[model samples]
Structure formats: C-alpha cells, structure tokens
Target: INHQTWYIKAEWRGIDLVPRMLELFEGHHEYPVTEKVRIDVLRRFGYYSTESNGHLSEYVAWYRKRPEEIARWIDTGSWINGETGGYLRVCTEGRNWFETEFPQWLAEAPKSFAASERSGEHGSYIIEGLETGRIYRGHFNVINGSTITNLPPDAVVEVPGYVDRNGLNIPRVGDLPLGCAAVCNQSISVQRLAVHAAVTGDDRLLRQAFLMDPLVGAVCTPPEIWQMVDEMLVAGEAWLPQYADAIAAAKARLAQGKAIPTRTGYAGAARLHTKTIDEMRADRVNSQRNAEATDKAKLRPAAAKKAG
Candidate 1:
C-alpha cells in the first residue's frame, strides 16, 4: 500500500528499495514496521548513523535540519555519508565512501578564511585560510591537517573570511607573526614552475637545474624533489630535455670509472704518519738511557775510592 502511494509512478531501477522491503517483510508480526525495514530504507537513500568516533557531528546536524540542502553539498563535494548527505555508494569488498570529490568542490568554493602569512623552516612562507585555506595549503602539499600551530607564532597572520572581486579580503585581515613572511617575497617563477612540474608529472627541468648546480636541490624539500622526479618519469618524453644535463653527468661519471665524489675530503690521504714519528722517539730514548748508565758507573767508582 505504501509503495502504491509513494513509488507507483517511480521507474524501477537496479536496486529498488520499497519493493524489496515489501517482499522481505511480508509475514512478520512487525511486518513493514521493523528496525530492519528502517535500516533498509535509510540505506537505499544513502543515509547511515554517524559513528561515535567520527568528528562529523556538525555536518550531520546541518544535514538533519536541512535534508534538501544535501544536493548543494554533494555538488560541492563537501557532503559525507553518516555525517552529511550525498555520498557515492560503491560496494566492492567493503562498503566505503571515498572523499575524492571534496577537492573538486574546494577548487571552486569561496575562500572562507586566511591565516597570517608564516615562514616555513627553510625560508618558505605558509599562508593559510581558516575554512577553505586547507585546500590551497594541501594543494601545494605544504602543511598537514587543519591547525597551523606548526607555523611560527611571531609571523604576521591574516585570515579574511570572504574576498572581493579584486581578490582582496572582506571582513577582517589580521596579522600573523613576522616569521610567516619568509617565503612571502619568494619568486613566483620558482613556485609556479615547481607546481607545473608536479601537475604535469615532469621532473626533467628540476633535475637539470639540480645537476647544473647542486644548490638548486637544497632550495626545495627532498620529498618535493622526489615527487617531481616521479611525475617527470610518468610524463616520459616531456621530461627528457630537463633531465638531459643530469643524465649526461651521470654517464660521464660512469665512463671515467670514478664514483660520485663525497662531500668529505679524499679517503686515501688519511694514512698513518705516526709510525715514523714513534720509531724516531724510541731511538732517542735508548740513547738517553745509555748516557745515564755511563754516568752512574763513573760515580760508583769514585765513591769506592773515597771509602778505601
């Protein structure tokens, strides 16, 4: 009767919930009014109880108050099942919903907050936003999680919740500690080129730069360099030109039968000069002992003559 009222006009799909529930609950005392029935209904609509351990209660509360708003949330990729609405139901070995869609939504989402610019460990600046700031920070593969406590407290901070057309902050722009400004004046060319290399999976340019001058490698993090290399290899031919210098240098070293030189001084020069010095000292000591014995023999004869 309920199906006739609610789903009579609805087209049958691969997994129809109402019909399945009706068939499954045909003869029980509770009939269509069981916990299983409720679970089944919620499952079909992509709803689930939030786990006690998850930190999505805020989103869950929002979802409960405005169920219809789920469409917008899902479109923005901010929605999560069990916490928020609109999650893809992918049933493989286990039932899990991936957060793959969130980044896409974040890319288009408005800036929610901004942190005061802070300096990174190696003269790098970290500018974060409060709500949407994590997106940009994560995109650059900078900091982890939400909090920016890892940043220096002395850096000047700024986090305007909203922004205007000129890309200026709306609301309030606060100052972070001065330490946050280390990378603020860094060349965009380096940052952009690095980002482009990563997105395109090209490391050839980075490798060439590093090879031509080893100091270039010191400017970026080790992980960043590895990531660029991985991407370049993945991109194949596009990275060859960039890596040409490094490759040539490697081949040259191989041909000369010389390993890459260590930063430390040469190993062979550290031989023992102590052997020659020790022998000379031993001869001097023996000569001193003989001279002392001759002087004592003369003294003993003079003492015997005085006694006689």
Candidate 2:
C-alpha cells in the first residue's frame, strides 16, 4: 500500500504538478529571489507584464527556456519561433532594455518605474503652524520613513496640509512680509507699468513716459528716456544736454494745456531724430538693401565655384 502511494505521488509530480509549480514559482518567488540584486536588476530590465495571465505567463516561460536565443535576437537581427513572429527582439541598450516580443508590456513597466523615481526625487514644501511662521524645506520618501533634522523653534509659522494625486502629503505656509500692503499701494503705478512691459515686451510704456509725461518719464519711466538718448546718440546729435532741455520744454507745454498735446516731449525729439516716419521707413529699407548687397558680395565666390 505504501509503495502504491509513493508511485501515485511520483506520477502526479511527473504529470502536471511539477510544471505548474515551476510556472508559479517562476512567476512570483523564483525571479524576485534576491531583494538587493532584484532592485538593481529591475532598475535596468524593469518587471514582467501584469496583464493577460495565460498568454503573458506562456510568453515569459518561453523566454526563460531559451536565454541564448533571446541574446542572439538582441545582438543580431534574429527571431525566436513563438506565437509572435521570430521578429521579436530583446536586449539591454544603455540603461534600457528593448524587447520586441512583449514590447508594450516591457516598455510600460520601465516608464512607470522612471515616473515613480522622478516623483521621489522632486522636493515638497512643508508648513508647520497656522498662526505662527514656522516651516521646513526638504524632500521625503514615501517608501521609507522621513527625518526632520532642521527646524527654527522661535519663528512664527503657519502649516496647511494637502495631498497630491499620487497621495503625497504637501504642506502650505501662509505668511506675509511686514508692511507689504502699504508698499504695494505706493508703488502700484510703476509696478503695473513694469509688469506690463515685462509681459508684453513692448516699449510703449517708455514711449508714453518720454512723450506724454517727462517728469513721470524721467523718474518712473526711465527706460523711455534712455531709449531717446540712444536714438539721439545714433543720429549724431552734438549735445545730449541740449536735446534733453528741448524735451523738458515740450513736456512743460503739454502740462500747461488741459487737453493732451497732439505732439509733445519725446515725440518732437523722435520727429527731429528721424525727420518723419516715412523717412525713417525709407532709411530702414536702405539699410536692409545694403546688408543684402554685402551678403551677395560675399556669396559671389561660392556661386562662381558652383558654376565652374
């Protein structure tokens, strides 16, 4: 009876039990055996497919059976005979593994791993108290525990907690500098103009200051005054001081009149600098023509060589 039971167990192991156990072991335990080595391994090759149980399991099994064939496919353009064509290629290039057979699954795992690693690297701000101004600035890992080594105990602080989409905790600090409101209000006009100039990259704010309001232009709108000075220098004006005096006179004339002057300040100076807008446009055209002529002169030798 004992002999019969031993024979029965041996037969069961030989039949389906051994193969099934091997498959299960390979799928879960065997491949992930060395935690230290597996981390570095998965960091390179990534992980296996979590989708399509029977088909994926079979695909993994086939690769495991013939390691040499997979290596050949990587080195030379070779294929393995499987459900997928012999065209399936697998190899590690640089830090990535290229697999043609299970391309989709293999590609997805590494990208997911990289994204997770990137998220781990990004730093988050921490806020401590609502009424006080205490805070911490550093990074923390979700997988491992965090250490809070740095802190300023005497500082007033505000701490607001929030979680991101990846379930990462983020802290917000709510604290304003002293006398911020009064300073902002006092400098609002120039601040708005500077912000507009920064956003638009248009020199109109400078132009407005120099042409419409020289007092404001000289102080708040210095950019326009400097621009006019540059133009005057370019136009071969003998004395900038004289031109500045002329601009000041124009500003005074506009200020005397309640209605905004049709022509004033830097507008008059610009008119004097270029004579007229039509003349300025003509000069620009002439300058472009001169540049083109100079380029053509340089290219003549190249054109002659091509012709020859």
Candidate 3:
C-alpha cells in the first residue's frame, strides 16, 4: 500500500517465505538462471528492510523501548538486536490509511477500471502437474499452522507452502526466532480471547482482549479501554446476539454519567480526504492510473514526489 515502495512488492516472498523456499527447492538448480537468481535473492535477503508485513515496525517500537519486558517475553537473546528485530517490527498498524485513502480509491472506481486492481493476496493454484503426471514445483500460500512449532496448532496461520500434483504441503517452520514468535503470540492471544468472548458472551474476556492489544495498551489507559470496549459492544449490539447481556450492562454503565475525557473531533495523526468525483475529473489520467494500478498509492502526490 505504501506507494513510494511499490518496487519492494517484487520481494513479496518475505522473510519466512524465503527460508522455506530455500529448503524446498534445495537441489533442483537446473536452469542457467539459477546463479544470477541466487545472487539476487541473497542480496535482497541481506540488504532489504525485510519485514513479513507492512507497518510492523510501529508495533514493535513498544517492545524495543522496553528491553526488560521484551527479554522476558521472548526468553532468547538471539533475535533481540536491530537486524532480526526488523522482522518483529513487521506487525501491522495504519487503519487510518484505509479509512482515508480507500474512499478516494472507491470514488475513482466509477471512472476507471479500478476493479482490476483489487486482487489482493489471491493467487493461482492450478498447476500443469495435475494433468501431466510429471512433477512441477511451485510455491503456494495456505491457511494452516505453517509457522513456528510453538504456536497453537489450531490457530490459523498464513504461510508459503509447496504445491504440485499431490496437494499443498505445509512444512513445519520449526520456531520463528523466539522474539518473532513472542510478538505473533501476543496478537494470537488477543484473537483467541476475542473469539472465546464472542462465542461465550464473556464481556470480561472481551475487555481483556482490548487491554491485551499492543496498540490499544500503548495508547489507552485501563479506564479508557474499558469505556471504549463498552461503547463498541453497545454500538455493535445488533450483530452481536451473544453480547445482549453485556450491551444492557454497558448501557447502565453509560447512564451513570461520569465518562473519561477523550479527544473529541480528533482527526487521526495521518488523515487524508477522499477526493470528490468532480475533484478527480480535474486529473483524469492520474485518477485512471490510480484506479487501475494494483499499487494504488503509486499515483498519490507524496508517492509521485518520492518516485521522482
């Protein structure tokens, strides 16, 4: 989504993926392309600001600031430094990007072939090996426990898999460097808590999930977390049949009148307005390009400046 860095998308076989690929296709160096490809691959693995996902750096800033807590969490010093921690920093943030930029993209859709740009993470799987009875190797993404062995088996994981005639094969990725697993485990804990809370109507667990979130915990106090959770549950009451009792309780709490101070009318730290259709019509070429390009941000003003 970061427009200035669209070239980096070519490196989508991320940190976890490259290692698995190196293992899967170990001895099959048949093509004249292998030498140059290997050099380029190693160069990227060595030099690029490799992260599993976007904006993870923002999330890990919390752990980096508190060394003792990070040490306790990961229990290993091997991956605590700047280099390996880069992977941990690959968590996620930036909801404001979606809120602000997405409407602009959607508005452009009516005037351009924007529909072609929405193929996010969807991949082709049907291989020639299925018809021919010969083995053709390729990588695939599957939903499974394909990450570190220590993570819960039932937890849904997105990882690269080996695909061919038989099926998608998810390999055991042993353990992510301890620190990396620690960061993933934190989010997993929140997800599990949220799921259990929704299924069982346990408001307490839901509150805890909010408290457990790295971004939420870093920004909001306990009182603010509690109030926010209550407000959300109440607002979403219609869809949350299991939360009926909790929503009623939340209304009673809100009725008590004393509310924590909050920043009213706060535009987020990085907010951009969605352009109106008429505004887009002023620059039809760029608007059409933004709508059709998979890297939507590539045509944004800041991105254009950076690209130049």
Candidate 4:
C-alpha cells in the first residue's frame, strides 16, 4: 500500500515526503487509501510507508500523538487496519489457547499424520525451484550491498531476485526514490540498535533504541522514555534476565519517588480494550476473520480517483 501510495503521491507531491505531504491534512477529500497512517507518513517524509497501519504506526513518530488525535486513527473496522497491540494480543491468546486446549483436543484428533498442501508461503517453493532448476522470481529481504545505492550496505532491503540451480541471485535495481531510501534508513537504524542491544545486553543501547523509535520519541521526552524503559524492565523481569542490574537501578529510582512526568491513563493512539470471549462470540465470524487474517482488508477498489 505504501509503495504504491508513495509512487502515486510522490509523482506529484514533491521529492521530500516531509513538509510537502502536510498539504494533505488541511482539507477533506475522498482519498482512496484505506490506511491513513501511510498518507501521514508521505506527508511527513515525502515517501511511502509499509506494513499494516496498526504495526507500522508504532515504528514512526507521527500519527500516534495526543489522546484526541489518537481517537481519529483508531478504527474498529478490523484489527490490522489499526488496532493497538493487535498482533501481540492475537498471538498471545492463540498460544495460551493451544497450551490449555490442544492436548485435550488431541485425544479426539486423527490418528494418522497426513501431509497438508502448502498454503501461500513460498519457502518450500523456493527450495523446490533451487533443487529442480526451475526459475522463480520473488521479493526477498537481503543484506543491502549495492541493490539500493542510497541505503546502508548492511541494511536488509526488500527487492526482487531470481532463484534456480545457481541459487538466489540479486539483480541490480539501482536506487529507490530519495525519499523512500531516507524512510527505510530510519528503520534500519532502529533495527541495528535492537539487534546490538539483544546481543550485548547493553542497557544504555537498549535505552537508545527506545529513543530512536518513531512513536516513542514523538510522544515522550527523554526522562519519560527512561522511566518507561524502567517500568517495562520491572514489569517484564521474568523474561528479561539480561536487564537485572538495569531493573534494579530502575526500582531504586522509583523508590526515591522522583519519577518523570507521563501522560497518565494514556493507552496510546489506537489502543482497544481487549474483548472478552463473550464479546468476541457476539460477532464470531467477523471477529474470527479479523483475528486470523493476514490481510485485514480484502476489498477491491472499484476505481480510485481524486475526489472533486
């Protein structure tokens, strides 16, 4: 959506997606895109954005602002359209249900282990093409060398590639639009910071990574971000053994009663209260569809024209 949105928008919006895209906000129009965040991104950075708006909005500094503005972005049409913490809530519930009920269900399950056909995933198809010497073209996330001249060499870039007996080969695609590369570069910085923080257990680096996050930085001051990290570490202590010392320090700080100011009761821009099982069952079909779907929306636009 962002790629196509950027191509069309950038063709006319100017090379930089930042200030130029802002022109879109002042007026009301029947814009064609379903994800509003992408439009906000183009207006801010002069490039297209990616991922569903729900997850994608978390990675940027805009859109998820004050509580009032947040209400505008929150849509209950479906989870992926822009539900807060949608992926985490869904996956966690799935795992919990599996652990609690799968064993019981297994007692009545089929005795034979029958192979099921592959669905839409391409991992097996790629392997088959390599072994059988059949040609395959697919978009891949690979370490960027020169495929995109503007981005960092180490950044993972998604681009077109070919597969066969010779193994995967990347074709030189030259450069993305200047604005596109800039937007991607920002994400690469965050990715690198996260990877390094995990490998080294560097609390300082972890804190830096939070500061680099688009939404985190946009909505928080340095002190608030620091306090938030401490809060998260203490809350997640069971899973964060590496942050033992950091958590201890955070606890000490809180104990001193000198905590930074924060937006009390702020759930975030598009957060939703978790639905109970009874609430979920009320609209079972649609709820199940939204929860399980990879793509939240499956609508085909009849025609996308600039509204007069």
Candidate 5:
C-alpha cells in the first residue's frame, strides 16, 4: 500500500525506513526532492510529515509568495519544486504523452501490454481487503470527527487507517503534535470558509477565506486580497453560476475605478519563466521525464533532522 513514499516499499519488504531516507539525503547540496522547502520545515517542526515536497510546500508560507525568496527555495530543474504554473504545464504534457503513447500501445502485441507490471495505486489493495476480509494498513483521506481533536470535525484529513470486510475504518489520531496541529488548524480554517463561501455565495466569507489562507494573507493586503477575488470571480464566471450576482457586484466595484491595484509582474515565489522547445531540448531526458511521469516526486519523501 502507498502509505508514505518511504513506507510504500518498506511496508512490503520490511526495510529500515526513516534513517535510510536521512542517509540518502545526508550530504546532498541540492534537493533530491523538493529540497529547500522540505528541509526547512523539518528543521522548524520537530516531526517528519509524510507528504512529499510539492504538496508540503504549498501549505507553508516560507517557500512561496515573493520572487526573491522563491528562487532560494526552488529547483529550476525539477517539476514539483520549480516555479509557478509548473503543475499545470506538467499535467498538459503528461496528457500529451499518454495521447501519443496510447495508439502505439494499442497496436503493440496484446500480451506485451498485458504482461507489464501493475501500478502502485492503493485502490486494488483496498478492494482486496474489503472483498476478502484482509486487513490493509495505509494512509487514507477521511473526514475528521474525533480522529484529530484539534482540527475541525468536518475537515478532511490524511491519516493511518485499515480496511477489512467492514470497509475503511478510521480511528482517533487523538492529537497531532502542537506544531503540526497548529499548521493543520490554519488550513482547516481556510478550507471551511472557502467551502461555505462557495456554497452560500457569500462575498464576505469568500474574502475572509482569502485573508485566512497562509500564503495569500502573507503576500497581500486586505483590499488587494478582495480585489484579487473579484478579478477571479469575473474571469471564472462561466463555471461559477452561483456567483452571478457576486460577479455582477464585483464588476460594478471595478467599474467605479476605486479598487486596490494588484501586481501583474508577481509570477509567484517558485514559478519559472516558460521555456521554448529549443530550450527544453537542451535537457531532453529531464524534459521528457518531467512531461511523462505522473507523480514526478514518486520516490522522494520528506527528511527532517534535529539540532544537537
């Protein structure tokens, strides 16, 4: 099962997990994964979280928000750790890769295709546990009730749980360490407000949600935050049918010409400028792997070391 990146192979083969990871990264100057953000957090927070660099980076305020700081934390050569819009570009290229490979896969011998190794996704194992009453231990995203006492009960949390004939059964995690829970509770507040604002179409709550977001609040003033939300609503009005009235209100506010200004040049803390095909061809192997791999940070996990 895919519990954590390190735990995946360890769970199956019983390898020494955490220390092996520290040794793997012991003296590397550059990140083997999302190097800067992960290492910094591990130093700041005593516990090692299971999330890889990409997902973990977004949750914290240290890695992103300013251009100057972004360069220090980001790896230009990597997919998950590079500048802004990297995820979208990588996703688009991945789709292109699949589209190009699918016909070739179809025309190839059926036995050749069918005999390939299976994927590492947890879906198959979960099904096996539920169908045959085997116990499968892994991390699952589940709604929080009493599982984490410090977090909002309605929020979703990633935690260890087991599957069996009874289905996915989650137990109380009691409480996260003080630092981790502090981080988690911040996210829960943003998520709770964002969901409520979306469902209720409350502009006030929506603005509050932005203000509560760690990165957004750190990077923008209240008026700037509100205006940014207005711009987003007006731009994405096509999919936001419930926000028609709110969009109209925001447009009227912008029409009055009193809205706080936003920075057009702020490309985000970790975003890189787009490269042309010739530029990408300079590093064909990495470019191709960046485009093709579904989870680019698949083998890489978090590493945190304590001070003596």
Candidate 6:
C-alpha cells in the first residue's frame, strides 16, 4: 500500500485486546494504561494534519467531554517511568514530544535495522510443531470475524493463535465483555463501510463511514460530516482513481456553495509544536537515540532520571 494508506494502520489499532489479554493472564486489570495509550495516540496522530486533518480535533474534544469517565479510568499503579507493563512518558505526558521529535529525527538521520538480530519492539506470535507438536502460546494478529463471534464476520481481528505445519490456527474467543464487544462493533461498522466504499467508489457509503465514526459523529454535525467527507475525497483525489466520477461530483458540490463555518487553524487540544533540528542538536544523544530506536516510545532511563 502507498504511504497515503499507511496512516490507517497507524490510527485504527485503538483499544485493542490488551485489556482482554490482561484479564485472561493476570485475572484482573484496569483500563488506565489502555486509556492513556488511546489518548496519547489521538494526540500523537492528531498532530499530523496532513494525515488526520480536522478529525484529530474531534477526538480530543470527545475525550475532553468525558473528563469524569477518563479520570475514573486512571489507576496510579499502572503508571511507569522506565519500565515495561506500565505507562511511560511517551504513553502519557511526553506523548507530544515523542510524536513530534521522533519523526523529525527519522527523516534527518535515517538508521538501518538490516544488520540487527533483535530490536526493542516485536510482535507476539506463537510458532508450533517445528520439531515436536509443541504449541508455544502467544497472540497473533489475524482476520478474526468468525473467531471473535461477536464482531462482524468480515472484520479483521487479532486473537491468540498457534502456527503449526498446517499453518496458523485461530480459536474462538467466544464473546468479549459486552462493553468491549460493543465498542469493537461500532468501529467495525465504520471499517466495513469504508472497505465497501473504497472497493466500489460509492461516495455515499464513504460519507456514511465518516458519519458512523465514533469521534467524528460525536463532534461533527451531519452537514459538517458531509462537507468534511467531500473535502477529504477531493484532497485525496490524486490517489483515488476509483473515485473518479465521485470526485467530479464532489468537486461540483464543493464549488456550488459556501462551506459551513469551521475552525480553520485549530490545533488539537493536546498538540505540541514539533522540535526544530537546532533544538534537537542541543540534546544530541537523545535525538540520536530517538533516530535509531525502532520503538519510538521505548522507555529512556536517562531521560526519566532527568525528569525525576
């Protein structure tokens, strides 16, 4: 897929099975860390105006609207500085710094991982039956509409699986907690509509997808959602050959009327200015580390010590 489409993966993995995994493995879990990750992701991804445009602001607004609920989700013990299994700076207060500075470091000082045997980040998957019929237990990201049992059959899902000579086998999770399933289903609805819209170039369905999106729907009026979809399609028209006829129609509609009033230059609520190269140079070691690190949010002991 093109770089234009990479943001889908970057943005869509919200409120995943980490909570469920915690419940299964550890017997109980709170959602503070998960909630922090969600909020930080919104702030981080929202800062990319080229990727998210105005949608980031909508997400921030939605979170802000539910301050009491979000506060309730917070668990102090789940917080961390330089440790795994908890919230680090990048997962919390320093999210903007990581989001803003890390990309700049990557673009300016590219690092090659080709020679590395191990990296700070890796996905969890189980390999089975290489020598014996041993089933190493871990989670695998796979298409899971049927396995999940609660979500739509067409939805992509991540579930626990094992890879054997027969290839990967996914087991039914039975049902997620009702609230979790409900949340997943809502997002899946938008995703399903989006896939159909992209394949068929049905602009109406595309608009419906945007309308059905949780944050967008919560924050934007119907007229605003309609107009936003039109603008997004027109802005992305070059990469959307399937939407040729739809693009023309959108162009005509956009041309015929004055747009609804919107905050033209509104930065997201939690946005931070990207660090300049000169400013980064002042902290050369940190900048260099950021440049080389595959996990941009990996805990930094020195930085954490300084912060303390």
Q: Which regions in candidate 6 have their CA more than 4 angstroms from the true location? A: 1-117, 120-135, 164-166, 300-308
Reference-based lDDT, each prediction = 0.31, 0.30, 0.51, 0.66, 0.69, 0.53
TM-score: the better of candidates 3 and 5: 5
Per-candidate TM-score against the hidden true structure: 0.20, 0.17, 0.59, 0.75, 0.79, 0.61
Writing each residue's lDDT as its tens digit, candidate 6 over 119-138 gives: 43323223324445565554
Q: With candidate 4 superimposed using the best TM-score fit, by how many Å does residue 69's alpha carbon deviate from the native?
A: 1.2
lDDT of 2: 0.30
**Which candidate has the highest TM-score of all?**
5
lDDT for each residue of candidate 2 in 1-308, tens digit (9 for 90 to 100): 00000000113635744224334434663233312222222233333222222122122222223433432212111111111221121111101211222354455655334534433222322323222334433433222111111212222222223433434354432222223222222233344554564355334553442433312332334544554534433354343343454445445544564432223433211011212334433565433332323121111110111343
Which pairs in model 2 have colliding backbones? 79-86, 129-158, 129-159, 132-156, 132-157, 133-156, 133-157, 134-156, 134-157
Model 1, range 209-256, lDDT digits (tens) per residue? 333232234334554554444444445645456555444554554456
- lDDT for 210 (candidate 3): 88
Give residue 264's lDDT in candidate 5 (0 to 100): 75
- For model 5, the stretches where C-alpha displacement exceeds 4 angstroms are 1-33, 97-116, 273-293, 299-308
266-297 in candidate 3: lDDT tens per residue?
64332234455556667666555544445433
Alpha-carbon shift of residue 228 in model 2 (angstroms): 7.8
Give the least accurate 10-residue stretch of model 2, judged by summed lDDT.
1-10
What TM-score does model 6 achieve against the real structure? Answer: 0.61
lDDT agreement of model 5 with the native: 0.69
Q: Could you list the CA RMSD of all candidates, in the order they appear? A: 36.8, 31.3, 12.0, 6.5, 6.1, 10.7
